[model samples]
Target: MTKRVFIIAAVSLYIISAYFSFYYFSTGSISGLTQKINLPLVKYKPPVDSKGNVIIDTSAPKTEECPLSGEMLTKAHKALWEKRRPLGVMIENSIDARPQSGLTSADIIYEAVAEGGITRFLAVFYCKDSDGYVGPVRSARVYFIDMLSEYGDFPLYAHVGGANCNRTTGSGCGNGAPADALGKIAKLKWVSYNDLNHIPYPVMWRDYDRLPNRATEHTVYSTTVKLWAYAGEKRKLSNVDDEGNEWNSQFDGWKFKDDESVNPSEAGKIDFIFWQGKSDYDVTWEYDSKGNSYKRLNGGTPHLNKNNDKQIEAKNVVIVFMAESTARDNYTEGSHLLYKTTGDGEAIIFQDGKAIKGRWRKKDVFTRIKFYDTRGSEVALNRGQVFIEILPKGNTVNY
Candidate 1:
């Protein structure tokens, strides 16, 4: 019996030991199992160079090496390199101007070059006010012209302030007065200010190089200067000539003629008209006022409006229209009309301190609409000029 018991215990111990060994081997807890089974172990081999130095793999698979060190050029590194290239060009190679100011001649020249790509520019500065101090103020315009002339042979004209003297008029006193041969040169080619906003490449040349016949002639005179453009049914103030003549005319029925030859050069000359008298004269002209008269000096305001807080609202649709002249009247399509609207509400048009509506239409020229909620109901306000917004009714909101 003792011999049989000993034999049974020994067999049981052997079975338990085998089971534990199999579990550990299957779970990989027992290392070198594959070796013990005569299987090969996986090994990593890095690529080598001719000198036996490890060649870091920078290829798409990302073998090795730092991207900054150029061992491997990652997508992120390439992108960063491209982004910095333009900035380098600008920093290392840029034209420099003299006597820099918030609104400096250098700034004007640089801006023209940057925008138009024109290497040359003729900045014509003129005085719009005629009273107050004189002396240096009168000569400042001439001085600027002389300074600009030193750089290149650009057509420069100066304006002399008269009762009607203003920037738009391009009229000046003495040799620079309007109707004078010089004024005509200053008013040469009616280039729209908008077109000139961005300087074109080969900046020295105009779109067509349609140089004014009068610009070639160096003459000076004075006369009643007016911008011959037409304003459709919509009436709004614009910049004035040296004589304080604003370009606010009403065209009941005007259209552009098919004849393209009528002052085709005028298109490039009248870049665009800007309003100058909407704000205080001192702020716009940057000149000091003496009693009832004003004189220009080193400073003047370029913008016409000053009250930034003021806003224009539309009670109804408001339309604005413009044309080169009454004889050449035509409606410009795709012209934008700004307004605010709600899901359900009355529209109001606001401009120049007045809330107006039903005053503009397609037949009348340019039209804009302003939505209002007269029912005292809630309305959503989406504010934007070009992009239209349609919102569900809620509470009264300001756009």
Candidate 2:
């Protein structure tokens, strides 16, 4: 037994030495000394097209409309998407994790304050593939699960960890608190089915090389193609689950329309903040008339995707005002938050350089949230990326 222990220790030390040597050679410094020392090495590569070309061909005819964002794509892209379901990844927006990798690739994004005035994103990917890694992956929150449920039957959810309660003490969640995300996932029977929590290997990795000086919490990443493949092979979940039930059987996709011809000066800019004094998470969207899109700015700086180095732009920006409160469960140092998700709320829909005052409604967790203008008609979003921001009720949006 002593010999075996010594052998194991020796092998572990050798592996660690090799890892640091390689890191120093590639990055010119061992800045990860303070990062998570237990992180696994990055070994997976981004996916490539089988045809030896880019994922999307700009010259191809854009006939098929994506159900997620209503963006038109080639038949080839549509065919590829049909074989997979939506993937909701938990991406952090910490100041240290700026210029995230794959925000522009997501079809739809839901942003809300995770805790302590820091915002997080539940990026839903389906109609298109990410340019590369999709994170800086973070832990899950209960309200994010509520929003992700609208995707379909057994949507692939990827997160590192989550807010959990001490059921024995009845402190964090089980007694009455609704902020226990991990518990909720277990009750939903998504443990090994679709809830990819701390999944190792080809699903997720800690890429210290991506951002050398970042902390471990902000170094985790995963590619969309790898996530989909893992769901299919390991969880028996794809376009259909193990029982052969299609994912979209009860799905409710939002309505979409072409860009409406409108004057640019009508609603040229949008500004909002999640918390009172947290300027780092402040958001601004400037409308572009020619492109019919809104370019995003964070903390007064243009937010760009690290993968392609392009500014993050969206055709539609929907702001939903809901009641927010703290869980008071003491799940973590930051404390978890709870949001009223499955009810009616005031909303503002921005599209085609115009802002439409509207209301948002959702029947339940699985039901799709829809936006309706003051005239009581559904607001059709323009064809492109959709960004949904959930703000505290009574928070003001300046446009």
Candidate 3:
């Protein structure tokens, strides 16, 4: 075997004979001499079994991204981000509609007080793999129109027809704030999934078992499979604006991290006072360190999703304080509350078990809203589901 030596100054391997000899001399006279060196030879060794049989591993590494959380995930868990379009289902959140269905599977849940201090939720699901029931579905509110607009490119909005009501016309005046909000958005030309039944696709139905015990209005529900199927058939899956101008244009979602950058305290008890009637509006969150998430409670008891028998959990809790206004609601026959959504406001974000005081700003309907701390640093959230609580000013959010 020849000895191999690598020369650093030039691109060549010098292989001397098995026996080496060295000589040092500097008598070279310049222009006429050149040397060509060879590289060292390497032996090849193939991987084989004990029997000298070649084996090729054909299994591919499984990897995917959860669109909602934007985190890399393995294929073992049912991915909700597989669908091309995000979906928003209007789920009722009254005393009657307790033990909600399919809430644990939502990516983001928006909660706001409806007509008479009763709150409602617009649960958004981008990863739509949940096949379970989604709601005791409710009618849309005026403000819900603006809230749902904060989601995907082409979002599927499923709700019953809604408008504000007057005390005179117990059937609802049809020209109140809720309907006015609906009309404003309709001018933007948003097509939706509703309970008109027999047009486009038929997906909304009532659970008879729930209807007997509760009001007929509170029994309407839909499933993820049904919504996906209906949306696909109705040609509502495309992200294009049929009328004119792009909707939800130029949006890059919030920043997320694998884990929180700051150390979180044991802020286990959370209080979300959504209304002046604290008796009816009381809500709380208890932290579970083992899961690194918060479990929801309504008035001191556990809040559960009846469909799957699971409590609502979130990695981030964002309470945005907005200016509130009142109007004559034709639907509820009382005062209609409208929360201004398109302005800069103070917000507090709870993540990694600690509460961070921040401010949120949204200039217009199309612009992306962001939360920043007092120093104007953008607040980063843990990569998971987030609950956006639209609390009015003077409301309490203690953790």
Compare the candidates by TM-score and give the number of the best one.
2
Candidate 3 on 1-399: residue-level lDDT in tens? 123333442333233321122211232222332332345786433245797532322232335555456544444332223334567788888878887788887888889887677888988876534437878888776676676666645567777665534345553444444445455546656645322221233477778685358887788887766776676657545334333323335556888877654443657667877766656657888777777787888766888888767889988888899887775444454665677889889998887777889899987765557899999999877777888888888877777
Give each model's whole-structure lDDT: 0.22, 0.90, 0.67
- TM values, all candidates: 0.14, 0.85, 0.75
Off by over 4 Å in 1: 1-194, 200-238, 241-244, 247-365, 372-399
Question: Predictions ranked by lDDT, top down?
Answer: 2, 3, 1
**Among all candidates shown, the one with the greatest lDDT:** 2
How would you encode candidate 2's per-residue C-alpha lDDT over 229-331 as one tens digit per residue? 8999888898999999999998899999998897788889999999999999999999988798999999999999999999999999999999999887756
- Which order, best to worst by TM-score? 2, 3, 1
Off by over 4 Å in 3: 1-62, 74-83, 152-154, 164-179, 192-202, 210-212, 236-249, 261-266, 329-332
Residues 1-399 of candidate 1 have per-residue lDDT tens digits of 999999999999999878769866666555544434445785445465797533433353532222111122333323222211000000000122111111111111111111112111222211111111111101112112222222211222222221222355433232233212222224433123201111222221121122123231111211111111110111111233333343222212111111111222211111111122311211111111111111111113232111121111111111222111111111122111111211223333322222222222221112112223344332222111111111112312121
lDDT of 2: 0.90
Error (Å) of candidate 2 at residue 329 is: 1.2
Each candidate's clash count: 74, 0, 9
| Weakest 10 consecutive residues of candidate 2 by summed lDDT | 39-48
